[model samples]
Target: MIKQPSIVIIDYGVGNTQSVANAIKFLGYKNVKISCDFNDIENADALILPGVGAFEEAIQNIKKRNLVEILNYQVLDLKKPILGICVGMQLLATYSEENGKHEGLNWIKGEVKKLNLSREFSVPHVGWNDVIIKSKDPLFTKNTDLSNFYFDHSFYFDCYDEQNVIAYCDYDIKVTAAVQKGNIFGVQFHPEKSHNNGLKMFRDFINSIS
Candidate 1:
């Protein structure tokens, strides 16, 4: 029998790690864990970085846990598949302009900037929005219902290279909903909270790793 890949949800003290874990477990993936320990991260076959806060705070929390080096080794050096959610997605950028200029993981070439929408559209960009698939990436292949992913964010990833963007949504202006660079992937929406549509996305992510 084939062994199930161990999936580690990096707990950097910035996201709903438990919720993400529950979702993964619900999908029947038994070898899932939430940890910040270097060994757990290094030994995992895949990683999930979930966040629900400011870019600066998230990055700082990750630094405090001494995860930068290990994460770099696993992601950049080993090329393990990773998925970043919401603010977690923003952390993969080159930098962010939220509050003040802050550096990110630089995994993908981009910057995080506030949604520059007019007064009518709101800033946080909460609730369900339709996703327009831009690339034929494997992570989005199984699902066709891309219209109702939950999103709660004030900022969005502004990828410098257009080729890296896999999907997008409209929030007054074009908001980047998803991105991918080699094995690195990110989504501005909260798939764990997005119900069935979100669950399918998790399944897709797991299948990609398999």
Candidate 2:
């Protein structure tokens, strides 16, 4: 039997951990678990932060779970492979203005803000959109030519390092779709909900560590 990589999907009472777990399992990874323990976050090979909800509440949950410090050590200090999806991606940034104003994990220098469309566009951008890959990252390998992936969100990350932006999808304005700085990575879209291409993307993410 293949020695499956061990991955931890953090659950702090936020969004779908099962779906993310299911995606990793779909990738043929055998040893995947949902961890509420902060120590599990520290000990895991890779970490996935998946969230759906307001910024403040999510941050509060992270803090309340006592996972902030260990996650910082694992992600920032250890430089382990880390992936954040949707609001989980936003949490990696410096700050957010979603519900009032709040601070993020600051692992990456960026801010999360509500999507300001041209009035005609919808507030929450849902469905499929083509993502333009800006850099040659392993996660987006041959992703530009493939069909569009799934997306559903109101806020996006405003990153300081433009070079870290690996991909972008057209919304109200062209926003940061995927950001990668060293071992830390974040995606605004949900690869699990994005069909086959997304499954490939998730599989790539699972096997990204070199």
Clashing residue pairs, candidate 1?
none
Query: Per-residue CA lDDT of candidate 1, range 23-71, in tens?
Result: 9999889999999988899899999999998899999999998899989
In the range 1-210, model 2's lDDT, one tens digit per residue, is 556677899999998799988887877787888988866776688989998888899999999988888887887788889899999999999999987889999988988988988988898988888888877457877465535888888899999888778888877698788889899988988888987878878877876765
Worst 10 residues of 2 by lDDT: 138-147
Local error of candidate 2 at 152, Å? 1.0
**lDDT of every predicted structure (CA atoms):** 0.91, 0.85
Q: Where does candidate 2 clash, by residue pair?
A: none
Candidate achieving the largest lDDT? 1
In terms of TM-score, the best-performing candidate is 1
Residue-level error in angstroms, candidate 1, position 24 = 0.8
At residue 102, candidate 1 shows an lDDT of 97
Q: How many pairs of residues collide in model 1?
A: 0
Give stretches of model 1 more than 4 Å off: none
